[model samples]
Target: MNIEIKVAKKSFNYSGPKNWEETEPWLYAKIFGIGKQLAEKPHALFALPQMIFQIPTNVLQFLFDRNAMRMVGVKDEEAQDEVMGQGYALLKIAQSFANSEAPFSWKVPKVKAAFLGYNYYGPGDSLGMLTFEEFWFAEAAYERNDTNALIAVLYRRDPYRKQTFSEELTEKTLKDLQALPELTKEMIVFNYQGCRLGFSKKFKHVFPKKSVEKDDEQQPKKTKKNSGGWLQVAIGMAGDSSVEFDALRKLNVIVALQMVENKLIKVKQLKRKTK
Candidate 1:
């Protein structure tokens, strides 16, 4: 939200994030740190405008003090108290704006058809538009925090064509993505994180569940080897054959995940029968 105030006989308008969804991940971390400081020291309220607005410390100090002294009935000694009061009021207003209780989920990006001079499209809201290969590679990139690779996988030049994954295209796209501004990269990552959350919720049954330990006598002990994470999942779906894997990767992500979920349910049923 925008807050307009006059300082040094000049009016200025400053804006802060209106909600958690609007806040950048880096800014959110700074705000989190500020919260801890405020909890320990109420006087930390004076530091908020500087943190939120990212203005010079001296300018903010002048803003508060000048505003405080303008009040009709104020002694010099009372100015400090008035400043603190104003800070507290501002803090409350900011809190009201920033508080968010709803679970965060991905919304369709506002700009869906193009980015950075490239004509491309993202996986539609259902994510059914992505090939399993593209989805898997994007998730792996996200796990590695590789922003360029993730962007390369999730966006494609052809929305209707089922193009095979191309190393040449990806390499060129990575160079293009690297030239993007830092803020643009952050926004892309933020949107992707939300999409991931939505995917997990939609395909919760396909994801591995945390195993609960049982009494030694009540359940047979089982061990599993550490393996490539998403790669391993892909391999299993492909029957561990390279040719089949390539074909499997061409399947739609929604279909691939549904197949995995069905297999998991059948395996569980068979295990119960054996027990």
Candidate 2:
């Protein structure tokens, strides 16, 4: 006789990755703080991890250095020429994508992902859902497939529209985003590295209580510019200036891929049939 007993598989809630604060506070900041901006519910759309992982390493390096070099102010016509020479390889890669047959539209995930860390409706509950196009809404549901903890922040204030995850697939949209206008060097550098910005102002005070309350009341209110990455080169937050550039470079690669996955870059169609 054979044993016939079977045990049930245990299923636990998705509590999110462990040690979010210690391990990846930057990622947490995007998933957490950006949503806090709206008076109503706010949701963040992130490119799927598989899409992010597909970016070529050289492209990532180019973007990282491009942003970093700009940050340090690589100026002058001669210097600019030298910079372009250094970026020749990157330019070739970009040209290849431009010549590809697949519509940039094709790169966007058929099923995109979002993260809803806070329940705007109530505790442990959801409100309304949104299609990925709309940036802000009363409430939006996070997709379940957003499992990979990695994300790239699209740093824009209210009404600042860029081609985000299929908002537009026109050549003009691709050109504008590629130029990265209204964006500071820091914003490009840090955001590309996946370091969350604007959270420093919120997360600055660890113990949110009486002391902080008194300080807030006493401090004069000041307007903070929406541009620039708040956490870029923030020694206090990172704990030291010794943080490795290699890691930063790697993280930015995903951000760069997210750019493609969002369809912000135009990939030329391989063949266009004559009408």
Best candidate (score: lDDT): 1
Per-candidate TM-scores read 0.54, 0.15
Cα lDDT for residue 139, candidate 2: 11
The per-model lDDT (C-alpha) reads 0.62, 0.26
**How does residue 11 of candidate 1 score in lDDT?**
55
Candidate 2 lDDT, 1-275, residue by residue in tens:
01111111211111122222222333433323332333253211111110212334433332335454455464344554555553443334323322322111111111112232221110000101111222111111112321111112232211223234332332332232332222222222323222212212223322112222224567745534433222232222334445543333223322322433333112223223322
Residue 60: error of model 1 in Å?
18
Q: Which stretches of candidate 2 lie over 4 Å from their true place?
A: 1-202, 205-243, 252-275
